[model samples]
Target chain A: MSLIPSHERPDGDPLRPIQRFCEVVTYCATLGIYAYGVDGPKVCLALPYCEDILGDADRQWINTGAITTLIDSACGSAILHALPQYEAIATLDLRVDYLRPAPAGGEMRCWAWCHRITSNVAFAQSEVYVEGIDEPVATSSASFMRLKPQKREAG
Target chain B: MIEPGHLKAEAALPPPEQFCRRIPHLQHLGMRYLPACVENHSAPVFILGFQDRLVGNTHLPALHGGAVASFMENSALLHLLMEQNGTSRLPKLIDFNIDYLRSAGPRDSFACCEVAKLGSRVVLVHIRCWQRHFDRPAALARAHYLWEPVSGNTELAEDIRP
Candidate 1:
């Protein structure tokens, strides 16, 4: 993965919550872990390379485990980024399908759309791609729980 | 202290050879297979409580994500190995999902899984990786398997005993 995104940010800018989230995701992705990201409209996240996520005994490409984590993290990050906006969506369920094996040594870009935001729940779908491509590597759909953030009683 | 139900035994372990047959990939990883409780129904589930090999970095390096995924996949595949108690066979994975709660510390872990549904064409499996200290879990997974049943093998209802 490239550090281009990090370098683009001007120095001494106090990090935003969303930016922090991106760093967490990037940290994991760079080390071959799965974590959340900054891009929305299609919420972005990264799935890093690791020997354990490979299926072929040969360890040539990513496997089902990596794909599974990417979809889950993408959906999770999307909900988190939009949490202040949609107060009621709980994650009811999520499903993902891998079109083919994603190559190792690169990060996955997950772009998700909030298809529907309802009174008590939100629905969304996402596509995962590598190195900015039109054909998706994987796709997913998710449902989130909706509830008002907890309030503290007056002392 | 470990919970009474969680502690593992030494005997009755399912050999890793069972996985090598089909995936042939796991064998190359050189992971040791420790036995789960015998009551788990000849399940292929095994545990590799924390070992130094799993640590990735110093100063509280979270358990490697790749390691976490490996444990999850191994737990799911154990169901196929369990099917052959006395023989050897490899089962094909149909589908699987995982919900990660937190990053694992550099400690031992317990891996367990089972076949929830078995049919002529497909089987469903649920797998989990529980940390030694944590109360909730490091991660949880569910997987589906496509079975190529051995001829002359009898079909039976899946036991939820484990």
Candidate 2:
């Protein structure tokens, strides 16, 4: 019983709204967060580092914040794989360890897995890498609090 | 009342008013400075309000998690820059750990930072984000920055040497 048809391959593009939300609200569209799909047990999303929008003051290196944002989006999207309903889930905590600064303007990709889920909490972990690069730039773990449905406001 | 060293440390620092102007990303997010008050005096309080483009979940009309995280990171970075006073190039990010206490509402959000430790080579800062009530924090973060002192700073070399 999938809450979100989009997450299940049988339902046809359940992650569409998530992708759109990433593009618009999160400013992740600038990071190129479009490519994604369910791969075996994990969900994968990939995008190149956008130097024009994601770079730092000198524009010489990728800002750590950009990498964090990418990891958050990927992790959230991965959580949606398990609970893909339209209702929003809030992130409770996020921890990212930067092993090394990512190469400036390199192609970055991420794979996320929903490791555990309970009645009200969900835990996810992910790893980010620069495309074709042997070393991963960062690793992240995040917890999401599933919120109860709220009363809708009238238009 | 402020401590003499605190005041002197602060005097060595840049005014909070100029922070938004100095960092491009903060400018991009439209973060603004708020004056000190009784509750928060450790550092200048900065704010990022609700905006259409900042919304990640249209259904819930909520802010993106990454944007909130980035805002918090910048908040800590701003505090670091103030303490460093051009002692180093932009501090390199070593790590970022964030805890979201609540679902940030669609309203103005404020951030305050506290420097846990300011060593010669590294600095650690704690930041909290709140809206409407400072008692209720929407998110909290601890960030570590690698401070690479710029060359020719005889002052810094001497301080670290002995």
Candidate 3:
């Protein structure tokens, strides 16, 4: 399991549904993409390369899908940082540009910034970087729609 | 997942079934290629089965956007590979853009990809994903893949030459 705790827990909210949603979201957790600290208008995350994500048995490279998942989640997380109370949001569109396929076996990180927040929509952009690498491995931008609050799932 | 490193050094081109099996993530996610429609159109069809692991919103019970997006991108790569089997090397993704038209219901999903443009060094593909109806798309995506053409020439290359 990921060690990073929910940023909303200490606030007694314990459930930033947005963050929790992404955590359980299939691609992110499977590949070890974790939520990092949040700055003023930006949210960050870490992506770790694991054996399971390797594209093939012989190649020491990860799949494009894994890279896309990291970008998509990073962009979506910034939407949570943009909201006043961290409400739920759904992705409306996501665009990712991969500069190159990073070699497998190193940890990569992403930082997402929300530049615009309207009454109903939020926009975010993010970049993926590998440690010890000069250029970014990939970049992405996405839009999310704020969702109405919902009651917690019944225990 | 087809090991990116092992793709070089050519041998007999594995059939589509074996090709998809090589990519662990695609198989784990239940992605499959059907050849029924390839005769009509140059592209093949891909289908992903619905399961608990793919759910995003447990309440609305919709398929996860990441899952759908990954599926589409993988299909784009698969279709491009199928069109010409000259190279065993996997294509590098240049970029992918996806638009969610509607919530994808939790069901088996079907999709197809068309090669919009194919250059010696770059290939562009458009994909449409749907569940219940062909006209109603749950999501659509455009993807670009970068790789040296099989023949290694832009126009001189015979479609796919090794």
Candidate 4:
């Protein structure tokens, strides 16, 4: 059975707000990453391959850096989705394991989920899959520091 | 695939700058090689000039975590390539772990790497990235790379000399 909520499925526009958030992040925007939608507790993102993002031109392989960007963005978005209310967050640490080379000319998709959220930190994990490939190309684990809400003062 | 005729020892190897330049993503990110004085450090240094497209948080106006990671990874690759005297194929990245020490502001970011262990099949590199003071680093990374052995290459047997 599908774990995603019916309303939050990709067919609906539930991800419009998250998509807008991704648009403002210049690095994410530059990479042409898009928020696909929310699946259950996970957030989905996609990166379409382009010639400029190639690391090994001879092999037509995508750069590891580009793959890192995709995972980071997806993990951050997952944290946002898991939170009850909007809160500022920053990456504390990230670890990526490259299982195999992701060849260029295919869209790389990622699904990230925030499994734990404490008062100070949030932990997320992501798996990156390439089009036509069944196994994950890469996997990542990341932690985000949740900034304390700033107290407003009367003018 | 490497051609047999293209294999040579030291003189025929392409410069690190040329190897770095051939990467489209590095060029896209505007990363450049900076020659390092032999006395200060052994490995070459790299600089990534701050650009609007590299920013992750416009509110804090900080460099993206991934951008910083990319710079450090590139730095490590350059270091390994220099140590091996260049290889026909690029080293495959096995894994990378990074810690964000501080937020990198809008400025040119610099990176340098230290090889922790040099093995016949794999090598480990530790990378540091900073915007201002070298002591105050913005990020630290450890990456492991699988070295693909090329036939008739004697340099791979010596391990990293430096």
Count of clashing residue pairs in every prediction: 20, 1, 8, 0
As for DockQ, the candidate ahead, 2 or 4, is 4
For model 2, residues B18-65, the per-residue Cα lDDT tens digits are: 443344456566666543442346566766767766666666677778
| Cα error, candidate 2, residue A41 (Å) | 2.5
lDDT-based ranking: 4, 3, 2, 1
Query: Model 1 misses residue B7 by how many Å?
Result: 1.9
Q: Return the interface RMSD of the candidates, in order shown, one decimal each.
A: 5.8, 2.8, 2.2, 1.1
- Model 4, residue B116: C-alpha shift (Å): 0.6
* TM-scores for every predicted model: 0.59, 0.77, 0.80, 0.86
Top of the candidates by TM-score:
4
Off by over 4 Å in 3: A1-19, A56-59, A147-155, B1-18, B37-42, B86-88, B150-162
Candidate 1's docking class is incorrect
**Which tens-of-lDDT digit does each residue in A32-133 have in candidate 4?**
888866767888888888976888776778899889989988999899888877788999999999999999899998889999987788999999999989
Ranking by TM-score: 4, 3, 2, 1
Per-residue alpha-carbon lDDT of model 3 for A39-152, expressed as tens digits? 556666777777556665445666777777777777777777666665668889999988877777788778788888777778999888877788988888899887774444
**Evaluation by DockQ, superior candidate among 2 and 3:** 3
lDDT of 4 by residue, B46-90 (tens): 778789999999999999888888878877887777676776578
In candidate 3, what are the lDDT values of residues B1-162, reduced to their tens digit? 122122221221223665655566666666776653433434566777777777766677888788889889888888867776635467778889999998888887777888888776678899999887767889999998876543434553445333
In candidate 1, position B139 carries an lDDT of 70
State the TM-score for model 2: 0.77
